[model samples]
Target chain A: MTAAELLSLTATISLVILGIAMLIAIIRVVIGPTLSDRILALDLLTVIAMGFVAAIAIRTGLMLYLDIAISLALLGFLATVALARYMLSRIKDEDDQP
Target chain B: MTALLATVLGCILLLLGSCFALLGAVGVLRLPDLYTRMHAASKAGAVGGGMILVAVALVSFDASIALRAVIGAAFLLLTTPVSAHLLARVSHRGGYHTQTTMFIDELAAASPSKGTLEQ
Candidate 1:
C-alpha cells in the first residue's frame, strides 16, 4: 500500500510484539532459578525496552525519543557490569570463608 | 520511488526485528538453564534491537534521526557482547551450571582454579 500506511502498520505491529516480549522477560525474571538468570532476564527486558522506544519514536515521528534508546543502551550495559562485579565479590567472600 | 522503497524495506526490517526479539524472549522462558538462555537473550536480543534501530533510521524523515539511530545501534552492538561475556564469566565463577550442556567444561578444565582469572 502507501508509505504512510506501511510505516504506521509496521510501527503498530512492532510495538505489540516488543510489548509481548517484555512481558515474557518479566515473567522469567520473577521466577528465574538463579540470581544470574534474573539478571539476564533484566538485560533482555532492557533490550526489548529499547526496541519499544524506537517503535514509539517512529510512530510519533518525533525523532527525539530515539535519544532515550541510546541512553538505555549504555545504562543497561553499565547495570550488567555492576551486577557481574557484585557476583564476583560474593564469590570471593565465599572463598575466603572456608 | 526511492522513498517508497526505503519505507517498504524499513517496514520489513522492523517486522523481522520484532520477531527475533519475540523469539529471544521465548527462548529465555523455555530454555532449561541460565547459560543457554543467556545465549539466546544476549545474542539474538542484541541483534534484534540493533535491527529496530536501523529500521528507525530508515523510516524517519530526517537525516538527524538516522544519525541518532546509527549511534544507538553501534552502542548497542558494542555493549551487549561485552556485557554478555562478563555475565557468562561471572556465572562460571559463581558456580552456575546448565544441565543440557552437551559439551565439555573447557574453561574449568583449562584453568582449574578460576579464582585468579577474575582477580
Candidate 2:
C-alpha cells in the first residue's frame, strides 16, 4: 500500500480500538458501585474522546482539530478535580460531626 | 523513503498506544477497589493517550500539529498524576472500600487521628 493508504488504514484501526475502550469506560460509569469509580471512568472517557478527535484529525488531514484536542486535554482535568474536591469536603463535614 | 518510514513508525506507535488504552479499560473493570483501579486507569490511560498524540505528530510532521500534540501530551502527563492523587485522597477521606490484600494505610498513619478507617 502507498503512504497515504497506510496512514488511513492505521487511522481506521486506531479508531476502532479507541471506540472499544470508550465503550467499556461508558459501561463502568453507568454501573460503577462507588463515586470514585464513576469519576475515574468519566476521566478515562474524556481522554478516549480526545484520542478519537486526534485520530479523526489525522485521517482527514486537518490541523485545526488538533486545537480542539488540546483544549479538551486541558479542560478535561477540571471535572475530575472538582469531583474529588466535592468528595473531600463531604469527608471533612463528616469528620466535623459530633 | 522517509514518508514510508514515518508512516511505519506512526502506525506502530498508534497500535501500541491503543493496546495500552485497551489494557487500562479492561483493568478498570477487572481490578478490585477504587484505589487499585485508579492506579490502572489513570496512569495507563494517560500514557496511552500521550503515545497516540505522539503518533499523530509523527504522521503529520508539521509545526502546528507537532506543537499542539506536544502541548497536549505534556498537559496529560502533568495532570494525570495530580488527578490520580486527588482521587486517592478523596477516596481515602470518603472511606472507600478496598480489597483484603491491600493493607497499607500510609496516609492515615501520617494524620495521627486515624482510627481504623480501613475496610
Candidate 3:
C-alpha cells in the first residue's frame, strides 16, 4: 500500500480504538455508584473525546480539530472542578445537621 | 520512506495509548474504593492522554498541532490531580470514613471535635 493509504488506514483503526475507549468511559458514567465516580468518569470521557479530535485531525490533515480538542480539555476541567465543589458543599451541609 | 515508518509507529503508539485509557476506564469500574479509583483515573488518564496526543502530533507533522497537543496534555496533568485531591478531601470531610482497611486517619485526628459532633 502507498504511504497515504497506510496513514489513512492507521488513522481509521486508531479512531475505532478511541471509540471503544469512549464507550467504556460512558459505561462508567452510567453505572458509577457515587457522585465522585461519575465525576471521574466524566473526566475520562473528555480525555477520550480529545483523542477522537486528535484522530480526526490526523486523518483529515486539518488543524482546526486541535483547537477543538484544547477547548474540550478546558471545558472538561471546569466541569470536574464544578462537580467537586458541589460534592464538597453537599457533604458539608450533611455534616452541619444534628 | 521515513514518512511510512512514522505513520506505522504513530499508529502503534496510538493503539497502545488507547489501551491504557481503556484500562483506566476499567479501573474506574472495578476499583474497590474512591481513592483507588482516583489513582487509576489520574495516572492512566494523564499518561494515556499524553501518549495519544504525542501520536497525533507525530502523525500530523505540524508544529502548531503538536504545540496544542502539548498544551492540552499539560492542562490534563495539572487538573486531574487537583480535582482528585478535592474529591478525596471532600469525601473525607463528609464523614465517608475509609472502611476498616484505613490504618491512619489524619483528618479524623486533626478534627476530633468535629468527629464527636457527627457521632
Candidate 4:
C-alpha cells in the first residue's frame, strides 16, 4: 500500500480508539462517587480530545490544527487547576466549621 | 524512502498512542479510588496525547509543523502532572482516602493537624 493510504488507515483506527476512550471517560464522569473523580475524568476527556485533534491533523494535512490542540491543552490545564482550588477551599471551609 | 519510513513510524506511534489513551480511560473508569484513578488517567493520558502529537510531527516532515507539534506535546506533558497533583492534593485534604488501598499517610504524618482534619 502507498504511504498516504497507510497514514489514512492509521488515522482512522486511531480516531476509533480515541472515541472509545472518550466514551469510557464519560462513563466515569457520570458515575463517579465524589467530585474529585468527576474532575479527574473530565481532565482525561480533554486529553483524549487533544488526541482527536492531532489525529484529524494527520488525516487532513492541516498543521494548523496542532495549534488548536495546544490551546486546548492550555485551557484544560487551567480549568483543572481552578476546579482543584475550588475543591480545596470548599474542604477547608468544612474543616473550619467544626 | 524517507517519506515511507516516516509514515510507517508515525503509524506505529499513532496506534501506540491510541492504545495508551484507551488504557487510561479504562483505568479511570475501573479504579477503586480517586487517587488510583488519577494516577492512571493523568500519566497515561498525557503520554498518549503527546505521542499522537509527535506522530503528527514525524509524518509532516516540515520544520514548522514539526515545531508546532512538538510544542503542543511538550505543553501537554508539562501541564498534566501539575493538574493531577493539584487534584490529588485537594482530594486528600477532602478525606477521599481509602483505607484498603492506601498503606501509609506520609503527608498526614508530616502535619499532624492536617491528619486530624482528614479524619
TM-scores for the candidates: 0.93, 0.91, 0.86, 0.93
Candidate chain B TM-scores, in order:
0.87, 0.85, 0.83, 0.88
lDDT of 1 by residue, A1-98 (tens): 77887788889999999999999999999997688888899998999998999888888887878998878877888898999899888778777985
- Clash-forming residue pairs, model 3: none
**DockQ per model, Cα:** 0.61, 0.59, 0.49, 0.67
Which of the two, 1 or 4, has more DockQ?
A: 4
What stretches of model 4 exceed 4 Å from their correct place? B98-100, B112-119
Return the interface RMSD of model 3.
3.8
lDDT of 2 by residue, B1-119 (tens): 88678779988888888888888888898887788888888888998889889988889888777877888899899998899899877676555633225677776566533112322
TM-score for candidate 4, please give it: 0.93
The true-versus-predicted C-alpha distance at residue B103 of model 1, in Å, is 3.1
Best model number under lDDT: 4
How do the residues A1-98 of candidate 4 rate in per-residue lDDT, one tens digit apiece? 88988999999999999999999999998887778888999999999998999899999988888889888888889999999888887777776786
lDDT score, residue A54, model 4? 87
TM-score head-to-head 1 vs 2, winner? 1
True lDDT of residue A69, candidate 3:
79
What's the true lDDT of residue B27 in model 4? 95
Query: What proportion of true contacts does candidate 1 retain?
Result: 0.79
User: What do the candidate models score in CA lDDT, each in turn?
Assistant: 0.85, 0.82, 0.76, 0.87
Candidate 3's TM-score reads 0.86
